[model samples]
Target: MATQTLHRGRLIDHLQLVVNDLESSRRFYAAVFDVLGVPIGGSGEDYFWADELFVSSAASRAAQGALTGRHHLAFQARDRAMVDAFHRAALAHGGRDNGAPGERAYHPGYYAAFVLDPDGNNIEAVHHGDADRSAASVEISF
Candidate 1:
C-alpha cells in the first residue's frame, strides 16, 4: 500500500472511490486533473491516486469487497478556461457531460463544469473567481 497524506482543512481528510475499472478511472482522472493543475501522486497495481483522491479496483484488499456508489466531488480550478478545458478533456476521455461549463447560482463567480465518470460519479471542476488564500494546500511528508 502507498502512504496516504492529507491537506488539513475544515472537513473530510480524504476520499477514496473504489471502481470496477481502475484503468478507465485512472485515464479519466488523469485528463481532468491535468487541466486542474494537480499531479498524480502515485500508483500501484490495484490503485492510483491524485492528491487527496484515491481510486482503487474492487479487487484490491482495501476495497473491502465493494464498489462505491455515485458521489459528487468537486476540484478547484484556476480559472474559467481551466474549467472549460477540464470539461473538454473529460468528454474526450470516457466521461459524459452532466453540466457544461458556466456560472451557477451557487454563489457569485462560481464558474464550473460537471461530468459523470465511468462509474457515474458526479465529478466537478470549479473556480470561485479571484480571491486570496492562505495557501494552495498544506503538504505533509513521512
Candidate 2:
C-alpha cells in the first residue's frame, strides 16, 4: 500500500464528542475512565485525563432520535496501575461498573475491564499480557 500524503496543519491528534444527553454519557464514561484512571477530559461538556486526551459533551441532534453503534472506544494504559485507577474513577464519576479488572486467558494475555455508559455504549480499558502459571487467568470473553 502506498503511504498517504501528509497535510500541512495540526493533525487529528484525537476527538471530542457532543452527545445528546451529557449526564448519561458522563455517568457511563466516568466509571469507565475511572477504572482506566486516565481522568476526566474536562468539565461541563468536557472530560479530562492526563494531558493528551480531552472529552467534552454537547447536545447533538444527530445523536437524538437514532440509535447508532459509534460510541465504542478503548484506551491503552501504561500498566495495571492505570487500569485500576480507571476503574476507581469511573465509579466515582457516575459510571456503572460493568466488569472488574482481571485477566483473560482466552487471549494470550488480556487484562481488561468493562462498563456501560449512559447511552448504553460498551466501553472498556484493556491491557495485553501473557498467561503464565504464576498468575490466575480467567475467561473474560462475552
Candidate 3:
C-alpha cells in the first residue's frame, strides 16, 4: 500500500477506540481510510491504527479496563468525491449507513456522509468545499 499522511490540526493529538473485535474494526477502518488517502499507521495482535485514530481489543493494556460508549468522529475529505467513496467503501467493509452523502446544513458547501462502524461509533467523512491554505499542517520539531 502507498503511504499517505493527513494534515493535523492542533486540537487533537490522538484518539482511541476500544472494540470487541479487533479484526472487524480493522477491516472496517482500513477500507474507509483507504478512500481518504490515509495509510494504516501500524497494527499488532490486539490493535490497529490509521493516522491518529487507534483501534484496539480489550486485551490490549491500553484497553484492559472497559469498552467505551459510542463516539462521533469526523475525518476531512479532500473533496466531495472522496467522501462518497468513503461511504461506499465503509459499507462494503462492515459499516452501516447513518447518513447518506449530501450537503449538510452545518454550513455552506458542507458535503458529508456518516457511517456507524462495527463498534457503533459514528464516523463521518466531510468536505468543506474549497479554500486556500497557507500550509496543509503545522510541523512541530522536537
TM-score winner = 1
Q: For each candidate in the order shown, give its overall lDDT on alpha carbons.
A: 0.89, 0.55, 0.89
State the TM-score for model 3.
0.90
Candidate 3, residue 17: the lDDT equals: 97
Q: Among all windows of ten consecutive residues in candidate 1, which has the lowest summed lDDT?
A: 4-13
Q: Model 2 lDDT vs. the true structure?
A: 0.55
Query: What does candidate 2's lDDT look like per residue over 22-141, in tens digits?
Result: 666666565655555446635643333332333444333433434454455666665676667777776666556888888867576677776665555556677776333442223232
TM-score of 2: 0.53
Runs with alpha carbons beyond 4 Å of true place in candidate 3: 1-10, 140-142
Whichever of 1 and 3 has more TM-score, that candidate is: 1
After superposition, which runs of candidate 1 have C-alpha atoms over 4 Å from their true positions? 1-6, 10-12
**RMSD versus native structure for model 2:** 11.0
